[model samples]
Target: MALAVCVLFDARTERRIRELWARLESRGVHTLATHTHGRHHPHLSYAVLREWDLEAVHQAVDRLPDGGPFTLTCQGTLAFPRGRAALAPSLTAELARRQESVVAAVRATGADLHRNYAEGAWVPHVSLATRAPGALLPVVVAAVADVLPMPLVVNRAALVDSGTGETVVLPRIP
Candidate 1:
């Protein structure tokens, strides 16, 4: 199972994202809302690990600063090379630094990090659809355009088991 470090949204933002997911699902677009585990939540991942020492990862991450809370502005739609479509966010300096810090802390644990999530390579996004067909791109974009520049507050972070939907580490970002 893959493990991920993610920044979770506040309740209002989470609700909005879930609502967007419902709209996309109605348009025949597959999304994390219907993920197999049935426990998917809207999140922006800082890193994903292919392999790891669980205890070591926990210890390392626990030592990093909470970085407090910050707001992310979703500006527009972004398409990944693998046919995934997401809401792209403005990567502010604070957000970039926080993410880079998380990457560093997680990497120090000897975990194999996903290259896409490495410090300089990470793309900040909240996924809207997976395997979205080329023809459906415009539809998806139109569905979410009115909500462009959505502001989401990152108030908490966690280490989750992607396969099982279990939170292994929940750091209180006070």
Candidate 2:
């Protein structure tokens, strides 16, 4: 099972993203919307652990900074070669620094990290659809294009189990 350190958005932002997901789902486009035990939340993952000891990870990250409801500007849609499309957020220096800290803290626990999340390799995004059909790309793009440069408030952080969609640890982000 994979564990992810994710920054969750506020209710308003969550609703906006869910609305987009609904639009995609209506078109039969597969997305995280129905994945992860059907409990997926709109979030920007900072790091993903391939292996981890739950308690150890919690202790390691508990001491890290959990500041404001930072604003993330979603520039536009970005697609992966594997048929996944996501909202690309402009990475601010502060977001990068926080992500680095999370990676460091998780690594300190001796957990195996996903290479894609390694310091310089991470790409911050809020996934919109996966396994999307080529025929549906234009539809998906058109649905979200008007929402470009969307602003979202990330006010919480959590350690989520990718397998069960359970929140393993939710540290209070001040």
Best by lDDT: 2
- For model 1 the local lDDT of residue 155 reads 79
Residues 29-122, candidate 2: write the lDDT tens digits: 8888886588888888989999999999888888886675789898888787677899999988988898998899999999999999998999
| Model 1 global lDDT (CA atoms, 0 to 1) | 0.85
Candidate 1 local Cα displacement, residue 129, angstroms: 0.4
RMSD of each: 1.4, 1.4
Candidate lDDT values, in order:
0.85, 0.86
lDDT of 2: 0.86
- For candidate 2, the per-residue lDDT at 48 reads 96
Candidate 1: C-alpha RMSD after superposition? 1.4
> What is the TM-score of each predicted model, taking all chains together?
0.95, 0.94
Using alpha carbons, what is the TM-score of model 1?
0.95
Off by over 4 Å in 1: none
